[model samples]
Target chain A: MLETLNQTTFLHTVVAIGSFTIFTIGLVGVLSKKNLFKIFLSLSIVESSLFLFFIGSHFEVGKAAPIVADGIKLFDGHMVDPVPQAMILTTIVIGVAVLALSLTFVVNYYRLSGNIDIDKMDELGEVQ
Target chain B: MFNFEITALGNMFFGLTVLVFVSLFFVPNKHRSVTLYSLLFASLACIFYASDLITLFIGWEIMGWSSYFLIAKTADKQTLQKYIVFNIGGAFTLLGAIILIYGACGSFVYSELDFSAVPSGQVTAITILLLLTLFVKSGIMPFHYWVVDSYSQSNDLFSAVLSAIISKTGVFAFILIFFQIITVQYLQTPILEVVAWLGVLTSIIATFKAINEDEAKRLLAYSSIAQVGYIVTILSIMGSLSLEAALYHTVIHTFVKLLLFINVAAIIYVSKQHRFSTLGGLLYKYPLNFILLVVGIISLAGMPPLGGFSSKFLIYTALLEEHKGLLLAAVLFSSASAFLYCYKLVYGIYLGQPTNPKTEAYPRIPLRFYVPQILGAVILITLGTIPGVIVPMFNGILGSVGFEPVLYRGVFVLGSDFASFNGGVVIGAFGLIFVLILLFFVRLKNRSVKPKDRLDISYCGEVPRADVNLHYGYGMGRELSRIGLIKMILSRSSHALWQRVSTLFGDLSGITQKLYTLSAQNMGLVIFAFFTILLYMGVK
Candidate 1:
């Protein structure tokens, strides 16, 4: 059953469903969180779900990592598609950068306005 | 990927306007300002030469930001805010249109946009979006909220460039997008009709606004809108003659604004004043500048023996050729009404007696200030005397853009199937008549009345003091407000419409903001609910 679960179609379906569920949870957290920090973390969670969906769907059972090693004989379908993994790696770095930058903005906002709750933040002077 | 192609239309506009930009270098400005100015020139060149939507967009964005920074140097925060918001909105609309075009054509290249394959409805939608961008850039009614403030607030010399050169970029874009990429055959008829009406309406409204404006630059700014309105209207007609008319008007309006603005800038530079209330009796102090401004306003009013008349005549002829009777009437009305403001512009600054006592103490205007004014004057005079000089160039532009060449009869004459005019005769008759009057005036010098005391003007039982406000410039246009139509036009503002739009956006943003303020548990529940909805949709 475990081996069957690792099959290509089965694994891809499971990853799609699981990552989508994670994305939904993050989306809900982002929608409902009062704290700026929680909202940003929730956004990061959503981004991670996207990365999982990209990388996990490309994985194949019994395939070697896309690296040249003593056991790995040739560069072919025997190795899982490496493009999605490479893309995910770049995406993760960007995600982290964005999250870090946003958090800094949030910190600055908190210091300046003294409120982490987005509802209470009105530095732009918008009418309620 | 980057691609640029040269067309005669681009050459005509860029070649003429670049001279204005190059002339700015002669005017003293900060090094950084010069750098920004050059950047704007390059971006405009990019826009004119761009063969692909991506390149066009990049240039459009650069032009927007560079102009923004240039304006921000002197503009107040509110003015800067208005400029950025409107320009960014225009840029986003342009981006959307480009993306939509790319989706339909599967390529960014203008040459490859095979709209025949796309559905007509989609094409119309894309055209409307593209038009929205052009409308905002051109400062048409409803989208023109930023123009008056930005023009009034920018550095004086840059205001000349803004009105003379930068505004024409929208005209260039209209020619490029509507005529070239989305050829006339593909455009829906009713939409073009609507565009034509919008242009004429903008002109009528802007003319009134211009007349009522006390601030000199703001008046000129409104005049620029009104002038471009005619171009837009003619362009919407999309005939060979109409295109020529639009191009001619574009060229004429550029020089007219350049001369007028720089002339005002010189006055402002000397007197340190921009309002009509404070500026007067400047004719004797700066006679050369005064004459140049007179020439400018004459041409701008489209009176004969000036370059303005040639273009205006061409425009009227084009409208007649199209049998657009109502449009012709409306345009003629606007053109006639323009004479009042033209008179106001001149009388406000040069004709009226000096209002302030310190007017006599203003410093001499620098010689460098006269360079651009002189260049502009020479060009206008040449175009006025030989209006046929640009006909071939206009024809070349038309041919390159795949439009039929307009009929040309002689070196000094321009005509279509309907009517024609001789620029040489117009200028010759006017010059001879003007010289005769001047000679007669000079010959009768002995008949001149003796000069009276400066403060000897008659008053109703009260002698007016030196400090009394005797200048008619301040109240020149005030009585125009008594007219019902003029009163209505002056009272209405586009600001309320834009405010409504922003308020709607604010409300939408308020709802979205709430999503970020919910508790953690509620967020989790919302997430589950969203997931369940997505799953159900997927299953269905």
Candidate 2:
């Protein structure tokens, strides 16, 4: 039973369900948030779910990380596709940068307007 | 990483860019203005020489922002906002069209486009998108709300550049994209017909608006729109002769606007006034400037013995050749009506009695102002005397753009298969008649009696006071607005449609903002519901 659980299809299904669950949680937080900080955090959470989906879908039951090391001497099918993993790393860096910048903006905005709740923020002076 | 190629069409516009820039340099501007002008010139060159759509787009963006900053130098916040918003919208539409073409052809290079292989529907979509971009840039009808404000509000000399050279970039893009890349064979007839009608209607409306205007620069701005409208109309015909006509008009208009705007700028510089109500009796004070303005207006009105008439003649013959009788008639109507605003322009500033006592004390115009005016006048006169001087250049442009060469017998004659005229003969006849009239007037000068006092004329058996109102310039075109046709045209505003569209976008953003204003937990719940819906669909 344990060996059967190692099947590629089963693993893919598990990864899909797990990422979907995280994505839903993050999405809900984002859609309901009034605080600027919390909304951004929720957006990052949603982004992480996308990262998991991309990397996990490319995984095989027996494949190792793309790195060549002690047991793996040559590049072959034994290593999972490296492109998606590399792309995810880049995405993670960009995600961190964006989050930091947004948080700084939120801080500045709070200092100026004395409000962090998006509902109370009306810098553009739009009516109702 | 970028490709640049010089086609004949590109060369023609690039030559115009150089000409206008050189003329602008002599206008005595600030260092910052000069820098911006150079930047604009370079960007225009980039656009004209671009061999690929991406390069063209980059140049287009630079041109837009440079002009924005240039206009921002003298314009108010609202006008700047309008200019940026509309120009950015136009740029985005152009980008969308370029992307669509790239998607279909797998390349952005002009020579690589394979419209023949693409579906007709996609081609039409791309053409419409590109046309939308050109329409906005060229200030065609509904998209023209930003033009008058920007032209009126910008620095005087720069306004000349905007009207003279910057506007033609749109015409350049239209010729390049529609004629070269898309090719006329693939264009649907109905679409061209629609474009033709749009051009004519814009001219008619803009002519009336020009007549109704009180400000000098604003009137000229509207006149610019009307003049470009004829070019657009002729271009829609897409015949060999029509293209030549369009090109000829483009050259004539560039010189005319440059001369007129600078002439107006000189007046404003000396008098510190812009409204016709404040400016009058300036002809005697600045006789040379007055003469320059007359030349500009006569060319603008397409009167005989000027370069404008030659282009107008070509346009009429082109339309007639195509058997577009109704279009030709409408064009003629607008041309005839243009005379009213042209008269108002001259009469309001130069021919009428002084409206204010301060008119006599205004400073003399600087010598530098005459440089560009003199250059423009000489070019206009030469083109008028021998219109065929530019025909060879236009023929080369046509050849590079893959159109058949227009017919011409020599350097003095211009015509197609249907009709022809000798520019030299027209100018000679006009000159002889003018000289004869002058000689006759000079001969009769000694016999005629002069009035003892200017205000001595009897007004209902009462002498009018020195301060009594006598100037008719301000009210010259006032009755035009009362006409039924003009009244209806004046009642409608293009701004209303654009405002409605903006409000719709605002409503959409408002809805999104509401979603963004909710509590974090509620947002999380909505996201969960969205995810569950997606999962449900995937499972099914």
Candidate 3:
């Protein structure tokens, strides 16, 4: 029984490592990407990794989804921590708000300036 | 309806009422004025009676949005967008902090959150977040980008409200942040120390920039930032002396800045110009505005016995007590720089020879212009003479925040020495002496003194020519803005920081566009590699 538990811990560590590597790939894509739409979608991918890590790290052997049903009781030992989940919900909302706002700014900027390449904007150049 | 414990609720509701009615109705200047006046009263009411963080935040958000709409009426939508975004950033930061605290303690009641009860890390986080929000709203360094851009573009009346009352909400927010939510014991780290240092640096740098600013509104914007920097430094000290010093500054800075901005607004209104090059010799015609602005500038310089001096004196004392050696030096340097800009503001635009060939101005201003100036000027003088009345008031404000209330009347009071006076007594004496001299000159009646036109300043080897556009206001103190330290911190252009951020965004988009260049076989290889890595990780 103890050996199985130890093996489970090592497996969890491996999963964590793999997930982190995927996260790095997504981050690299985000940093290197130049298209407005693609950059935003890359950010979405990054958010997904975070959600997976959060939900996955809380997983335990034989544990089930953290919700109540006919058989599953509230606050059962089989369920994961509720606090991180609630926090992630708030984080998701805030993230969405910020993303929407920034995209709107981008859209409006495109509408006004015609060119979205920030490298091209020199309306107010640095004073010597 | 909920039997609210917050007295500020009624006032906030009243402000919203005005905001609603004004937005719906055509509300010509009279209706606008009445609504603005009522909103002003409502804000003042909110200032007095805010109970908890929730109530305070409500009042605070209301003030910002109302002022935003008011300024939006004047500025283009882009300027309005910048204004709204910056303010919302501040509001949301405050909200995030309050929510965080509430989550920790399961309570929204600010009065119940004892500074000693919370973990130090939580306290630190809360204070830092609150400071960042307030600093931005107050237009402190680094976060001061929105100020000059939006302020210069906003309408005159809305700009006045923005300069005077709207900015004070940040001060109000700071009072709560520093005095109520934070304790010196809790701030074991030197966060407040950093804030103090930043404050001094902000003032010094911004003051240097102000001396060289060309636009009247932009100059006032820089000057306002510098003044607020001083107040922020004093508040961060958290001692009784510093807190009182800050509040005194809050009142005085409001009065002096309001007086200056309104007079400048009047100039823009009358002359229909904003650049100094187009303005000169206003003192010859609008003497009341000239006098009020001159006094206002004098107060701004912290000249003895004026409203400016009283608060500045307290600030110097607070610095002395703390023995903030470098900070003190910065304060003195900024104060000295005040002379360059203040002189330029007074002499270049108002006193110097008019450069315009068409030198005649609109000869006079209406009562609307004069009334605001008088109200602002009177408050400056009154606050300077009897700051004793507000000393307890500051203490009361501090007390509400849960910090130790600063005693205003004690022997340790700053700037009480004759050297750092409000200059009220001396100014009065000077006025009397001037009157007596004028009388003597009148009684002798020997030499006739002709009133010279502003365009008639005697130039080299030439008589005063009517065709000469002397252009007295051009290039006054522009060189003073070249202070390397200030230039480094201040946005180099009107669109400096925002432009960079926007560029970075564009570059990001550009880079993202390149990702689709890969072949379908390469993409399959990537997928194969990914699954192989996953398998390897699981087996390991």
Best by DockQ: 2
lDDT of 1 by residue, A1-128 (tens): 88787688998999999999999899877877888899989989999999989888888888878997887666897888888888888988998899889999989988888899966754443345
For residues B327-394, write the lDDT of model 2, one tens digit per residue.
Answer: 99999999999999998888889976677778878988999888889888998888888888888888
> Which of candidates 2 and 3 is the stronger one according to DockQ?
2
Candidate 2 residues A10-67, lDDT tens each? Answer: 8889889999999878876777677888889889998999999888889887887788
lDDT per residue for candidate 3 within B1-540, as digits (tens), equals: 011243322233234234323332321232265565566556545643565667666766776776766666667765776677778888888888888777666666656666666787887788777887888788888777787777788776556556665666667667665665555677754887888888888888788778777788888888888988998888887777787788778777776776787788778776788888778777778888888997798789987656787788788887888787778888989998898889878876787667664558364666566665676688677656654555655665556445565454432233433223334465576568879998998988778544466544344576655655566457666454475655564446547567677679878877766555444334545776798899999999
**What is the Cα root-mean-square deviation between model 2 and the actual structure?**
8.5
**Rank list by TM-score:** 2, 1, 3
lDDT string, candidate 1, B212-319, tens digits = 888899999999999989999999999999999999999999989988988888888778899988877778888988899989999999998989999999999999
Write candidate 3's Cα lDDT for A73-114 as tens digits.
578787777878898899899889988987997798889888
Reference-based TM-score of each model: 0.78, 0.79, 0.68
Global fold similarity of model 3 (TM-score): 0.68
DockQ of 2: 0.19
What TM-score would chain B receive for each of the candidates shown? 0.93, 0.93, 0.81
Q: TM-score: which candidate is best? A: 2
